[model samples]
Target: MSAAAGAEAWGLAGLASNDPGDIHFDIVLRGYDREQVDERLRFLGDELATAEQALAAARERTAGLEEELASARGELERRVPDPDVGFGNRVEKILRLAEEEAAEIRQRAGTRPRRSSSRPGPRPSSSTPCAMMSSSGCVAPRTCSTSTSTRPGSPTDSRGGSPERRVAWSPRTGED
Candidate 1:
């Protein structure tokens, strides 16, 4: 019939003519020698033992490295200074800057005169009627009252007006 059928028929005829039990026993004895099987088993056992020893050695090395790292970190902590102990140095720096500013202010105040003397006459006293003239010749009438509502460190004659009215002092100008 077909090629597969023909091969299957031949295989069945060969199985019917031969004793299957005898063929299987002969194949098993030829494929497996007792001494060779024992030797292979012993070799596998030796390889497993070698692998276990290597694993143990690796674990011991890892543990030793961890202990050494901890010891080194402990020594470093003892050698380095603590940050909390440096607070006094920071306070000293702030106080030094404050003292320098105060000394500079005192020196400037001592060197400069209190009032400028370039005006035409004596400064207008409080309770006098004064008229302020603008740069464009526009005059505005202002009352000079002796009021205590004066700005601190201002040169106003108790009238909320200063002699240098046109001057605007700013720290960015850097002028004395």
Candidate 2:
């Protein structure tokens, strides 16, 4: 008898069973088991539909995540500063500040005239032109006047001091 005839006569008791393993097909005279093949096809059809749905959902989620990543990358690019313009501005500001400080230091340092610290010894008179000797120099006046004095050889201050005292310094000698 044919394989189909066997299934019909057997009444296929396990036809409604979920798994193909739950049913058995009878082989007859070197014929293909149509019943077994039909049961396997049914199982595969049901499983394929579920797998296809899950695959579609996964692909959709991946696409959404990729869009979010692209947006984040764009925001990061906007927030970062340009290297050339930003660093150039900072360097220019620093150089300008340094130049101003250098100018102030130059003004504070010079060979301008001031009071002598040692004894009121020989120095240039006020009429003589001042000259640069070393880091510091002074154009002395003929009067023995100083802000504060103690030694007899040095100039005296206004603390019961006498203005009549004079210092004889040579203006043309170029000596202090």
Query: Residue 84 of model 2: what lDDT?
Result: 95
* lDDT, candidate 1, at 160: 40
Over 1-176, each residue of candidate 2 has an lDDT whose tens digit, in order, gives: 43334435657544435575776566767775786667545655666777899999999999999999999999999999889989999677666655764576457445555454343433333342322222233323232221333443334432433223233333445363
Model 1 residue 109 CA deviation in Å: 3.3
Per-model TM against the reference: 0.37, 0.41
* lDDT by candidate, in order shown: 0.50, 0.54
Q: After the best TM-score superposition of candidate 2, give how far the Cα of residue 41 lies from its true spot, in angstroms.
A: 1.6
Q: Candidate 2 at residue 124, lDDT? A: 37
TM-score of model 1 relative to the true fold? 0.37
lDDT of 1 by residue, 1-176 (tens): 43223324544222221243522111354685454344434444665777899999999999999999999999999999888767877677556655764587569759987655343324444454433333454234544343232333345444444443122222222231
